[model samples]
Target: MLEEVKNYKLKHKNLKLIPITTKNYWEIGWLELKKEQEEFVGDNFKSMAYAYATVMEGKYAKAFGIYDGDESIGFLLIGHNSYSFEGCPKTLMHSYDLWRIMIDKDYQNIGYGKDAVKLAIDYILTFPDGEEDIITTSYVEGNECAKHIYESFGFKPNGDNYEDEITLVLKVK
Candidate 1:
């Protein structure tokens, strides 16, 4: 857990991962989906437009907003090709692709991104009595910072690539 996420209680100063709903979709889609962020993740990845159309409209993915207290600072999407167009790692039963996770430039560092990733993994762990499961994600080549962060959570490069991005996986037990 990140030091910033003090607790889960409603009144506490904690990071939250909320499902994106119709009421807040448009606002969130445009808030953190900036040009630089898009280019950084490579061509195959999409931020706002792709995420909303696929996850919100097409059911290709599921999305959550990263909030600090009451403010939205980032976004996350989980899915795979089997579920829709965006495919994650191949799994025997079920798994999460961790398709997209980003913290707005303004909110970079200060543990928001780290805790958000941890929260995402925590969400995955709750699957079916918290049995061990696979969660896969990819990062654009040269983004060692991301590799480090995800690795800190036990994600490891398995010699796979999503498009040109290096693929990594975590097995939650």
Candidate 2:
């Protein structure tokens, strides 16, 4: 799966990483996160709720939608966060958090989620050096599937947890 994802990102003419904008925000926000997947996602949010909260409240947040041809399959958000947990540190102000990641139920098991994760990490690596090189995210306990996918791409546990989820970090090198 890792090799498949890496290769897909290289020759990805069909997959696209599109910025979530005002006009098309509803498209991804409205996509289903499915009830079974909700336990892993740590919330009942329908992607758009995260979008609205990020847009209207958390000024530091940014959202994106994943597209395969014309179909929106996944949604994710990234932003600076210092208050999402209790032991949050000052260095995190220079860091970014992947606040949410989800693929539509119908889109599961087809590698869309893997491609989306690659896209997000690639996007994070685009910044100039000395400008925050860490990206963090979490998955609720019992979501070993998520942990495996993330770990496949070099994300490691940084000994942190948010609520019931285990925190993981990827350092862009």
Candidate 3:
């Protein structure tokens, strides 16, 4: 499920990926966030809805949205989680649990998904001191497209599975 990382261009003529700020919250909420969650995650939509609501409530530190010009094409939320690497002590840090990620259905086949992920990696790698970082994400077993994208970014199984979800991780040195 790995492919060479490439600078893929977005299909939308004037697409731009940007961080979500307070000013754009209501717009994002109305346009992207309020849409029926089932359109994005099938039966898991309820959980996804709750996740978005949590983020909106400030339960997460940061949330980003990928916009096609002024319209939201996709969005992602990242938050801190406690973790330890192979016998290390638990530390308070950021981990990309990828609570939710969605791209407009019309924009699915385009490179926006991959580009959005690259943007995420670039943003996460910017932590000061070049400290090691880890990103964790999960996808339903049959979502081949997503599995490919995550694997292409070097994420591997973490030996944990919840129902049909398989968790994967990438550690950046």
Candidate 4:
């Protein structure tokens, strides 16, 4: 899986999902969404904390900074077999979840979000943590931008909800 992701990085050149690290944590921490957009995606810091908690519980979770070359433009977090998480819907127990994603306000609507989605799908396809038959994600009810992006990649809502957010899934196997 690592090899596949490496090959993908070489081909893409500009856009990549670099895992969070001690050296680059500060830069990623400063990445932010627009004020109104925060309501939909929540805050990156909170997402990171959740990822950390998920991992500490002996499950799979990974967080990355979405970068274009050397610039940090967004954040992404993914988890596998995460249905055991306290609030997760039982329907997603066996899936890989694109748990969270956010592009900085400065980088929105200029294809960065679209490219990041592609990079994320490529990464998930590698099955970095473990194998899963499908990938899942969700967006808040009114977040049309997220709805369009996920749907563009063939993610269909599966008639499930986690709080106010609607669940969408893409079958990969």
Candidate 5:
């Protein structure tokens, strides 16, 4: 644990990950979804317009934003468990599902995402008397970068795909 903490601190020297709240929700939301939509549709104006409106709509699961000083640099969305499916049994489950993760394009390829995920895993593992022995997340089919990062943290695919999402699991035990 000490080593992990040290590594995290080293990686995030000037960065801090904070939970998202109502006050800075707009900034956080725009940073998280805006770039991806623009890249997806190849148009910034429409993407920005849609993201601005949807963000205010407040329809995310659990959301967190990483900040470097006052500027939001990354965001993660964890959806609450809604149903059970094959390979991932519902038995003895007390885990939050990592739904979406987005980092600023400028911060990509650095170690920020890895450190953020480590922070999230550490937070979950510290839960007192929690039945959660695992952390579950998914990556898009063509997102090789994400798959590699999650695998570095010991997450393995569970052979389950819902639409374009491929499920991966990290066991804490």
Candidate 6:
């Protein structure tokens, strides 16, 4: 395991990923991204709805409000032992999935998105659901910014794609 992640901290120290709850979901719902970037990631409400549905179906999925101090600045969703669809690699089963992450328009380009990713990686290293070797995520093919941020942390495309999205994986075993 990448034990060092337990000590990970963002250069912007106030940034954090707080679990989304009824008390704060409303604030997370209000976060907005640039119009052109909307196609890259789903809105918080939709992502949360999917999280709910997946949990209802006996899967593990959780949403988090990405906060800078007390302000809700973004959203993140993570899954474990998921993606049972056709064409999914057998290797990805029983692994962690960085399902969705997004930063509000006002917070973009100030390094929060990158920092939030680091926090997400830190959380995954804690193995919230269970221990696993791989963490996976996908982005719409043209979302170069997402690709860059994920790649910066060693995620690599694994020759898999679903529709317009391409899958990337980081081996943490």
Q: On a 0 to 100 scale, what is the lDDT of residue 108 in model 6?
A: 89
Q: Write one digit per residue (lDDT tens) for candidate 6, span 1-173.
A: 34444444577888888988899988998899899998889988999998998899999998999988998889999999877888776656768989999999998898898898888888888898889988898899899999998887888898867789888888897
Worst 10 residues of 4 by lDDT: 1-10
Report, for all candidates in order, the number of backbone clashes: 4, 0, 0, 0, 0, 0
How many Å off is the CA of 114 in candidate 2? 0.8
C-alpha lDDT score of every prediction, in listed order: 0.65, 0.69, 0.60, 0.83, 0.60, 0.86
Candidate 2 residue 39 Cα shift, in angstroms, is 1.8
Candidate 5 TM-score to native: 0.70
Ranking by TM-score: 6, 4, 2, 1, 5, 3
- Identify the runs in model 3 with alpha carbons over 4 angstroms from their true place: 1-15, 30-60, 82-94, 128-132
True-structure RMSD, every candidate: 5.3, 3.8, 5.9, 4.1, 6.2, 2.1
What local lDDT score does residue 144 receive in model 4, on the 0 to 100 scale? 98
Top candidate (lDDT):
6
Compose the digit string of candidate 1's lDDT tens values, residues 45-92: 345556556655544456788888788888887664423335533441
lDDT of 2 by residue, 1-173 (tens): 23433454533458777887777787776677667777676332445565567557634666778788888887887676534445664435567777778888898877777777878777766652235667777788888778887887877887766468788877753
- Comparing 3 with 5 on TM-score, the higher-scoring candidate is 5
Predicted candidate 3 versus true structure: per-residue lDDT over 44-139, tens digit per residue = 234335555765665544566678777777766555552334542232234656555667665677787787777666666665223446767777
Better of 1 and 3 by TM-score: 1
Question: Global lDDT for candidate 2?
Answer: 0.69
Candidate 6 lDDT score relative to the true structure = 0.86
- Clashing residue pairs in candidate 1 are 80-87, 80-88, 81-86, 81-87
Off by over 4 Å in 2: 1-12, 42-59, 81-92, 128-130
For 37-141, candidate 4 gives per-residue lDDT tens digits of 878986777878888888898988899999888989999988888667578786578888888899999989888876787788888888988888888899999
TM-score of 4: 0.89
